[model samples]
Target: MKNALKEIILAAATAAHQKGIFPSSDFCEVVLEEPKADSHGDLSTNMAMQMAKTQRMSPRKIAETLIDHLDDTRGLIDRTEIAGPGFINFFIRPSAWYPVLAAIHEQDDQYGRCDLGKGTRIQIEFVSSNPTGPLHVGHGRGGAVGDSTANILSFCGFDVQKEYYINDSGRQIQTLGMSVYLRGKELLGETVDFPDTCYQGDYIRDLAGELLEREGRELFDKSEAETIMPCARYAAEKITEGMRADLVDFGVTFDQWFSEQSLYDSGKVAGDIRDFKEKGLIYEKDGALWFKTSDYGDEKDRVVVRQNGQTTYFASDITYHKDKFERGFQKVIDVWGADHHGYIPRMKAAVVASGYDRDQFNVLLVQLVNLLRAGQPVAMSTRAGEFVTLSDVVKEVGRDAARFIFLTRHYESSLDFDLELAKQKTNDNPVYYVQYVHARISSIHRKAGSDGLDVSGFAPSDLSALETREDIVLIKALARYPEAVETAGALREPHRITYYLMTLSAAFHTYYNRHRVLCEDDLKLTRARLYLISAVQKVIRNGLALLGVSAPDAM
Candidate 1:
């Protein structure tokens, strides 16, 4: 319907231009959008205002000329009004909205989908936490946002690959190994001093105990240097396994688990530096190799290799991103913590330096999650290993509630997840409220079935029975589902879908309370209402599914 309106206006403008009503006949763009207030109209456009300078006339006069040329002879638009300073508002016929219901019924699960992306290959890397310990609440929030954004893009016709980059070759992994090794020696009653830089998590002790059970007293006899590598490898494997399990419980499964160490093992890091040097983007300074990132808008030049001859993490990141592009991804999106905001400029500079378009690379900065219980902040310390784990949150709140709450806010904004509120079954919980709408509609269908009415098979021809204001408003909300999805996907914001579902649920709840769905005296109205609510049920299910939330028939 939006496309149809834009075409109508564009054709009118072209015809008017050809008839010498305007100076230029080449009007290539037309925007048709919905007005905020219902009284304004169904759709509004400012084509006349845009053409005022080109047509050499007042905006209102041009608007009048375009309106005179508009062909609504097909009964698509009921009326057109000139509002404000030359704004053309289109009021679509109420009967024109009935096709939306038919679309919902026919498309079923695929109703709100659009082919806006046209199958662009995209890679989204998210929640690439170091495998030093269990994932915390912050990682959980990133998981929800990244997973849902990938789902939305895929629904919008993009070929999306979800990936988790493992930081297994960094200093953190070495620290984890030393932590487990010291703990293993301590388990053998050795008087070894543990350093402050070692990981303090109790899981390190658990890994030590497991190693003792497997290798017995031989582990105690090995030198510290020999023990470090084995312990690090074992701890990294175990912790990474736990991370995978937790994500699975949260309903997030990645298409690939990329290793950071692969860049070094495959010589990609050195090869990248050589390529940059060949392009004169690299220079030697004080016995260290520096990349001229400042030329590409970085705060200053960055060292790719230190004076000690070890490559920096930034060097490895550049290589990894280059590998992503070389693998044929047209676009790459990285979801990182808000603290990494300073890293975006350097990364984007690296993309440009590597001969890739800067616009093809994007970083989504996800803010922190502050978990609370009854309005009180929960204390967490990752260094001390006393923080709440993602698995713990999922076990307490359930995956559906946890994910829904995590996605209730925009990724750029901090979220305060209330533990008690999420556990409640009341209307105050948005997930419960939205799920209840689906369940409520399902119950209505069951009631109609028991009353010997074929509600599923009934297709009323005279939808004019749904001419009431509440019925029309509900229909309008239902019709906005596709627009909501398209906007959310285009903006890469999943919170928009949540807001839409909440508004639609509220509208349905109000209408259900005020009106009767199974009217015995008026079977025509009953069938019509049932059909409308059924469409509502399908839309709610589709929206929730995109957010990775469940829509139960009985809640």
Candidate 2:
């Protein structure tokens, strides 16, 4: 209907221009927006004002001329008005919205899916935590955002691959090895001083104990350097496996688990640096190789290789991202902790320095999660291994509640996850509030079916029975599901679907309370309402699926 309205107005403008009544047949962009207030109209556009300068006339006059030429052959627009500043407000016929319900029923799961990405290859790398310890709440939040983002993008017709880049190499792993090694020596009755640089976690001791039992005393008899790598590999492999298991339990499974060591091992890092040097993007200063990041919008130059000849962590990141583009992804999105917010510019610089478009690189900086019981904050520390793991949260609250809660807010904002509220079956709990609508609608269908009404087989002729105010509002909300998904995907904000679900759920609950779907008095109206709510059910299910949450038949 929005597209129809745009066509009608554009046709009118073209007619006006052909008759030489309006100058410049080429006009500015015609954007139709829904007015905030219902009285303003169903949709609004400012094409006349946009064309005022081109037509060399008053916006009001041009609006009037264009309005006069509108054909309305499709009979979609009820009326049109020239409002303040020459805004053309379109009042669409109420009957036009009824078709939305039919469309929803016909499309089903494919209703909200769109082609905004148009099959563009996109890679989303998220929650790439160091394989040194269990995943903390922050990683959980990132996992949710990244997984949902990939889901939404895939729904929007992007060739999406979800990946988790494993930081299995470098200094962190060495420290983890040392931490486990020192703990292993202590387990062997050797008096060794543990350095403060070592990881302080009970899991480290557990890894040491496991290594002692598995490899025995002979392995420990080797030189400390020899034992360090084995311990590091063992602990890293164990921790990474735990992370993968936890993420799967949390309702996120990646398409790939990329190893950071692969870049160095495959010589991609050195080959990439050589290419950069050939392109003159790499330079030397004080015996260190620096990338010309400042020239590509970074705050200053960044060292890819230190004076000691060891590549920095940033070097591997640059290679990884560049490798992402080389692997045929037109766009790369990285989900990182908000603490890495400052690193975005330099990363963007690296992307551009590597000959990729700046717009092709995007980052979602997810803020910390503040877990609470009731209203009080729960204490947590990642280094001390005292923080609540994602697995623990999922076990307590269930995966659906956790994913929905993690996605309740935009990724840039901090989330306050209340264990008590999530467990409650009340309307105050947002996930339950939304899920109940689906369950309630399912109950309605069951009731209608048992009551001898063919609710599932509802075939509509004229939906004039759905002419009530609440009916129109609900139908309009249903009509906007695709818009919500498109906006969420285009803007990279997964919370839009969450907000849409909440609103739709509220509207459905209000309507359900005020009216009866399986009314015995008016059979026609009952079937109409049944079909409408069925569309609602389908949409709710689709939205929850995008967020990786379940829309249960019984909550």
Candidate 3:
């Protein structure tokens, strides 16, 4: 529908130019909208207001000129009125919306699919939690947002690769190993003082038990120097296994699990630092090696390697971005928590320092989610291992509800995840609302064949008979899906889809409450209405699928 409006607006522009209203054809991108009240108009555009200053005429005159040229609309437009401040409000005919039902039926699940992306290669890296502990609810939000965003962009024809950056070469992995080893030593009746650096989760105890069952207690009793690295490796594997299972159960699968350790093992980090050094981007000061990130946009120079001979996390990050660009992605998007907002500038500086276009790198900051149980906040302390894991939420509310609730808001906004609200099966829960629409449509279809309706000879009657205001309302809502999908894909926002689903479901429920389809008043009209509802069912299913939420026919 947005594309259709653009076409109409451009034609209006041509008509205005022919009347000597403008010298050039370039005009502002006019906004096409639907008024809040049903009495206003079906669709409205502010083209006249945008052209007023350029054409040096009153907006009313420009609106009249454009409406005069709108003569060739062939009754698709019922009437045109000049609204406030010279806005052209188009009251479209029922025919204009009726064809949308046919289009939806013909297209089925492919209704809103588009090619705006033109197959541009883009990579989105997110939920790259360290393989040191189980993934908590914080990681759940990131997973939902990232996965749904990728699904939307892909549906719009972008070549997108969802990736997870595994931080395996870090101190956290060592801490996980120490945690497991200390727990195992305790099990072996050995006196041990567990450090604050060790992991405190009960999952660490399970991993230690498994390791002891296989390798015995002698492994932990070995020299600390010989034991720590192996313990870290084992703990990393155990944690990563759990994370992979959790993500998979949550309906997310990354195309790539990139490793930070691989960057060091492959010598890519050393090579990148050496190249930056040769480019005079690196220097030594105060016995520390630093990158001149300030030259790009950072507030100060960042130390790549300390005098203690250990490279900082930022040093390895430079190599990671370099690796992503090396893989031929035109753009790299990193989804990080809002706490890491200050890190974006330096990451962009590293990309520029590595001789890549700074604009090609983008950091999307996902604001934190505050988990609430009942009406109170759920306090969590990671050090104490009292955090709610993503799996815990999934197990409690089910995966579909979890994904839907997590994606119900914009990623940049702080999300208040209320456990009480999420568990509800009523109208307050948006997921159930959409699923109920699907189930209702399915029930209508089931009754059609049993009502002695001929299945083979049946064809959807002309939608011109769909004249009720509620019927047209549902048709218009279905027609606006492509526009919603395109806007969401272009903006990289999944919440738009959630908003659309809620509106679409509202229209469906409204129509369902007022009309009876299985009655004998008009069987042909009954089939037509059922066909329209069937199309709605398909759309709801497809939209929910994109968000990784299920649409059950029976539920």
Candidate 4:
């Protein structure tokens, strides 16, 4: 549909060129928009207004000329109107949209797919939660956003890589080890005080039990420095295992689990710092190695290495990004929590300093998620090991319900995920609303098959014969699916798919309530209606699949 729209605009431009008028190619970016109110038309574009300055004419005149020159595709486009301020609104015929049902039937699950990306290599790094504790609701939000985003990109024809950057070389892992060790000691009847910095989740006890089973009492009684590192290593591994299980249950997988420790082991961090020093981009100030990030529009010069000779998180990030680019990814998308919002500029500056185009990198700051139970906020305390873990949420609500609820809101907005609301089987839970449509469609197909009708190799012609208004609405919504997918994928906003699925399912349910697809007398119409409804069902299924949500044929 995007390509179709582009062809229409380009044809109009070519006509203006033939008329010895400066043909407007710049209208390419002129917002080709869908009318907010359905009464306006099927589709609208502001190409004329965008060309007004170049054409040396008012937008209305330019629209009139362009509309006159638009090529006719049979009767697909009934007419093109130049509305207020040169808005070109195209009124496409019913037959034009009717083909979309056939197209869906023909293409099946691959209807909305495109080759726009052309297999460009891309890497999306997201949800690299620390191994110190189990993933919370905040981490769940990141998981859904990152997984769905990568899924959307993959559907759009990119050779996409999903990555998780493990912060295994950090202080947090050590704190986790100490927490587990202390819990183990307490279990052994030793009065051990838990450190304030240690992870205080009940999962720590589980990790401790594993350590006890592995190393026994000898390692437990070892000296603090010797015991802490190995214990931390064990704890980190255990916690990361839990993270993996949780994500697997949530339906996300990573192509790579990049270790921060590798950067240090391979001397990439030192090499990057040395390279920056050679380029005069680094300087020693008050015993710290400072990178000239301020020169690249950052707020201030940032320390890559502190006065104590230890590299900061920023240094590790610099080498990691450098490694990402060197891996030959044409584009890199990093999904960071919103609290790390300030880190965006410095990372981009480092990429620029490393001599890479800034456009190649994108940082998406997922705002946050505040979990609620019934209608009140759920209090969480990591120290007491009493927080609502992501796994807990999954157990409370099934994976499909959990994922659909998490994705119901945009990633950039704070989410108020309510346990009770998400668990509902009604329309309040959009997962069910969308799935019900799929199941209903499936039921219709089953009925069609049982009635001895040959559904295979069936072709739908004369869609006008199916005259229910609900049928038209369903066809219209299905027709808009390709455009919806294009918009959602282009904008990297998966929430649009959620919204679209809801609207599509609503149309199906409304039609189901008002109209009947199965009848003994109107067998041909029933079959045609089933064909139409089943196509819509496939679209809904595909859309849910893109969001990593399930569309069950039953319940």
TM-score of each: 0.96, 0.96, 0.96, 0.92
Stretches of candidate 1 exceeding 4 Å from the true structure: none
Over all chains combined, what TM-score does candidate 3 have? 0.96
Task: List the global CA lDDT of all models.
Answer: 0.91, 0.91, 0.86, 0.83
Candidate 3 structure quality by residue, lDDT tens digits, 311-347: 9999999999989989999888888998999999999
Which of candidates 2 and 4 is the stronger one according to TM-score? 2
Per-residue lDDT of model 2, residues 1-555, tens digit only: 777787888899999999999878887877999899989998999888889888999999999998999999867888988899899998888888888988897899999888999999999999999998888878889998999999999999999999999998888999999899999999999999988778988999999999999999777888999999999999999999999999989989989999999999999999999999998999989999999999989899999999999999999999999899999999999999999988999999999888889999999999989999999999997756688988889999999999999999998989999999999999999999999999998998787777787544455663788888788889988988998999999999999999999999999988888887777878788889888898999999999999999999986
Instruction: List per-candidate RMSD values in Å.
Output: 1.7, 1.7, 1.7, 2.6
Residue 156 displacement (Å), model 3: 1.2
lDDT of 3 at 477: 92
lDDT value for model 1:
0.91
Which residue pairs of candidate 4 clash?
200-385, 201-385
lDDT of 1 at 378: 95
Expressed as tens digits, the lDDT of each residue in 242-326 for candidate 4 is 8999999988889999999899999999998999999999999999999999988799999989999988989999999999999
> Could you tell me the lDDT of residue 376 within candidate 2?
99
Q: How close is candidate 4 to the true structure, as a TM-score?
A: 0.92
